[model samples]
Target chain A: MMKIFGKVAAIVAGSALVATAAFAEDRKSYPAPKDHPLSEIISGYEFRTPETRALQDDDFENPAYILLDLGAELWSTADGAAGKSCASCHGDAAESMKGIGASFPKWSKERNKAITVEQQINICREEQMQADTWKWTKDPNMLGMTIFVKNQSRGMPIVLDNSPEMETVRKLGEEVYYTRYGQLDMSCANCHEDYYGNYIRADMLSQGQINGFPTYRLKWNGVGSTHRRFKGCMKNIRANPFKPQGEEFTALEAYMMYRAVGLPIETPSVRN
Target chain B: MRFAALVLSGVFMASVASAEEIKKVEIVDGAVQASLTGKPGDAVAGAKVFKGRRAGNCLACHGNKDMSGEQFHGETGPIMDGVADRYSTEQLRAIVVNSKKVFGDHTLMPAFYEVDRLSRVAKKFEGKTVLSAQQVEDVVAYLLTLKE
Candidate 1:
């Protein structure tokens, strides 16, 4: 009985020590090697299930191809008062849009911010195509067009330009990535950086790469933009998500793409 | 090792005694002595909380031998096979209440009942713990059954 009480006393004492220690908030920075900065990056694509990878490899088998086909149709159809199609200004997307998506989320002087491909699409619709901008969230035309444009750049490496003018915005993106938020007190880095290879249940976490924006997720059952996926992640941690195409999400997209430099663009990539 | 340093430190008894004074649960020496029913918890109900998404979400980062058939079991943290042999009931209770109490504050596992030291918490959830005292007990009860 004396030994039993002694064990209980030790257990109680250990619990107390844990409760009172100062909580450490040690944040880790990017472990980029000076010689080969891009070598450290790992795309979530490498971690996808074989079935999902196979679906992405075959265009005919990929459900996202449906959206890609629709986008091709929308590219030729004239719209708005000008009756100008996207093909009108830039003939044959294969020739005009080869490496365009690879350098997206670029700094736009007129907009005074980093703009995603979706925003650029809207800008073209208003100025060039003269059609009303597609809806921001879950618009079939938007997703289709996005996949169509991004698909052209498939196998091309992501290479967003980091101009001096865009440094502040890029820094803001980094801040957002590292900042812990929500009731769970988790930052994007907590999962994508620190626990990159660990499983958060059955789902193996990749580095939260956005090289495959407008991805076709089995869970989503439809194509979703980078902003759409970011909103979903925020909601998962019980945080109030910002507007889908808002400044915050666009900034996050820009930062994500920057982190994914050198990763081959895999638009409409399949994921579980 | 940090774990060895902590064990050797004299602060264990001092911290546990202070925590017991503030919380609803009792602490003996260094272990938690919490009991929702003043009896052993129901294992069946405990399993539900263990796998709940909004509650414990243990499966989010823990693989369990008993739950091998369940989809999406994680492997970030140590697996739960034979966990009953590894930790005492009181030690398990303390971990369920606040994992930092056993592991440390930097662990990915959230403190299911700790209401303090968290940032950016939604206004509606302010001062509210992640799990009820009963749920903590239930989870502890469920973990105790995971024998090798």
Candidate 2:
């Protein structure tokens, strides 16, 4: 599914930045669109009108909605060898899990790392839910279920804990946010921080809030979760993507979400 | 007589059940919740968060750089109108998290879920992420209030 142009463009852009950076610091240059249509803002969060903020949503029978159903069914079904459903242990997801989605990428003392909400689900599934860990981007059941599980806490304000015990995880996340990475040699701060208000191509820069996500897009033709957005950012940076349940990701999730701090949630937004 | 009684009961029962479903939506976290207020969304908050540098910070892109006046709306994306009527809050949340899942070949969108799906450092970021699920929801809550 890797587009040929995407690779060609990435290589062209990656080396170009390096070449330009080594020679053009006194010049102050704009980085070229060497990879994946370089953008300052992800179109999803852009505020468009009802008609222009297009979506495949008008189609209720669209296959996309099925993902939600799959998620709903998976919500209550048992998965563990002990035959425990997410509901069995969580005790009616609606009640016990109220506002749970809005508090994730938490630090785990037991694991000595930050854990994304999805990883939390994955761990529960493997240890508590007893189901096999989902494959990266392939298992609809897991993906759909994760989206639905996350959607449950849509309106809640972000309320992650920051105990003294979680100090290490927070520090690690902070490191990642500031550390420079990827072929472009840009850190999260490079675009989202230092040059936040600048232009990448035709688009404007944004401070990048995680509040409105799993958004409906005319481009993808359906709603997608936050993890999918994470994947794209990595790809844009030209870094090899990690597995869905990898450790570093959990920490980064902690950093990104926590940095967002008091922003309101945007669970299933529509985007152009 | 029997038909009339049955129809009346069905209507009464349906109304009772529908009312119960509405109760599950949490809106009383005080004025901060934004569900029960003037207009669909608190345009004031939308204006503040949307324009603030660290909050929603929407003014970064769509509109002119000047954060002055109601008309300094974004241009890259369409100007904000009645967003509540456009889509329910849930629909908006998914888009904010990951537009790629919905919009194919869209140059402007990225995935917010995998947090650090990209390995920023060789092995250091192998299991990293970009944002957490809760952040996605909170933004969604704020967006729903963007109605007239």
What's the TM for model 2?
Answer: 0.50
| Interface root-mean-square deviation, each candidate | 5.2, 9.6
List residue ranges in candidate 2 displaced over 4 A.
A1-65, A136-138, A195-199, A202-204, A221-225, A241-243, B1-148
Q: Tens-digit lDDT track for model 1 on A1-272? A: 23643464466446434422211112112343355323367667667777888998888898888888999999898998789988898889988988878887788898787887888889999998678999876898999988888888998987767697556776787888887666666788877766665568767777798877788889988888788888888777666677887887877777777787777888878877
Quote the positional error of residue A171 for candidate 1 in Å: 2.0
- When summed lDDT is taken over every stretch of 10 residues in candidate 1 chain A, the lowest stretch is A20-29
Could you say which candidate leads in lDDT?
1
Counted clashes in each candidate structure = 15, 74
